[model samples]
Target: MTDYGHDLLFGTFTTPSAQGAQHVLDLAVTADRAGLDLVTFQDHPYQPAFLDTWTLLAYVAARTERIRVSGNVLSLPLRPPAVLARAAASLDVLSGGRFELGLGAGAFWDGVAAMGGRRLTPGQGVEALREAITIIRDVWDTEAVGGVRQDGRYYQVVGARRGPRPAHDIDIWVGSYRPRMLALTGAMADGWLPTIEYLPRGVASLPGLNARIDEAAEAAGRSPRDVRRLMNFMNVSFSPDDDGLLAGPPARWVEQLADLALTHGVTAFFIGGDDAGAIERYAAEVAPAVREIVSRERGHYGSMP
Candidate 1:
């Protein structure tokens, strides 16, 4: 087992379909009440059929009491880093620190260009993401002697005032897979966010990718533990018997996910589903069972694990 020894977290990913706004909100509330650790939504600024993610997040923060809210991966190319940092901090403060920043180097080039966002090449996207992280973190540094100053090829912030500090330390989780992005996550981000279905080789690819992150972390003088690992199960199918990855009943999910926690050290697993009852099933049934099993087998999690 890899056993990075991080605490386990459970969450739900809801699509921001404009027609299903109330249903989405209700599902988020259900997840929060069911003791899920987080409630995340995708952010696609150029999508006309979707509700604005930031607006929905603010409403969710006001409605839910404890569930940490975030973009499954907010498109950084469309959001100015300084303003995004301030918005995140404001929400974090307002929600009593129940917030995390899940970011992505831009995707959907056509949609992005339609919205007046630059359609960056893959390399430029990665570099821009790095620069954005720098700008955002600097903007959040209330203790810095001087203000934020990041003059990068893609983004440049000159002496921007840092204020409206977050209620607690906010985490920047990057959704990345390539080598450069993985290294960036290790050196700078607090967590690595990747969807299981999109992985080139599923969990089979984790060891190599994680090794890259670890090496980069060590190179940057940061412990590998500094980068938490979070994965989301996209398009799950629940049934009464074992089928496949997140495709079976609660027990099957618990067993498979617990294995992931023990073997790969992926502490957080977010389910991409919109059905409220199924969300409850995942939150109340699958999540707790996985936690209990991992805690028992891992030891350091104690009884609560």
Candidate 2:
């Protein structure tokens, strides 16, 4: 078992479709009212059918009360790090410290190029993201003596004035899967956010992937637990019988999630769907159950002689 000893968090992941704008807001409110810890929306700036993720996030933050809001993973290629940092800080302050950043290295190069973002190879994308993280953090470091200055291959910031620190220390969660991205996540990011469905070998891929992050963290002189593990469940269902993964009943979900926490050290769970009922059930039933089970297991292990 590989418990990270972090508190378990449950949340919803809703699509930011322009056609379903009101519905998306309703889902965020539902998750908030249902007591979910966080609510996230997919970010695809190139998608004409989707609302701007950052704008939608601001609106949703105003509409919701307690639930935290974030992009499932904001596309970094289209968002300049300095401006993105200030915007994030502004939203974090506006939301009363209820904002977290889930960011990604750019995907869909053709669409990015069409949208006026420079196309980058996968390796370059990783390096660019690393540089972006540095710039973003520098922009957030208002306590620093001088303005932010970084001359990097991908981003160049010359003495950029930093102000408007966030209301809270907003965690930067990176949506990463590959080796370089995973390593970067461990070395620099606060959390790892990866969709389970996208894993090459499904859940079985986690151990090796997490090992990569763990090794990277260790090599970087950081503890592996420094990076919290978060998973997005895109293919979830509340069925009567057993299907697979998170497709079973709420009890099954609770069990599976508790096991994930105890065995794999996944501390956060985001259910990706627009179903209000599922959100409610996940909040009302599965979340508490998973937390209780994991807490009990941790206590039991701690008491072992």
lDDT of 2 at 271: 92
Q: Model 2: runs farther than 4 Å from truth? A: 303-305
Give the top-scoring candidate (lDDT). 2
TM-score, candidate number 1: 0.96
Question: For this target, which candidate reaches the highest TM-score against the unseen true structure?
Answer: 2
Q: Across residues 114-221, which tens digit of lDDT does each residue of candidate 1 receive?
A: 999998998999999888988888878898888888878988888889977899899999999999899999999999999998899998989888899989999999
Question: Which residue pairs clash in candidate 1?
Answer: none
RMSD of 2: 1.5
Model 2: what TM-score?
0.98
In candidate 2, position 251 carries an lDDT of: 93
Cα lDDT tens digits, model 2, 119-233, are: 9999999999999999998888899999999999999999999978999998999999899999999999999999999999988888899899999988999988889999999
Overall local distance difference test of candidate 1:
0.89
Listed per model in order, the count of residue pairs whose N, CA or C atoms clash below 3 Å is 0, 0
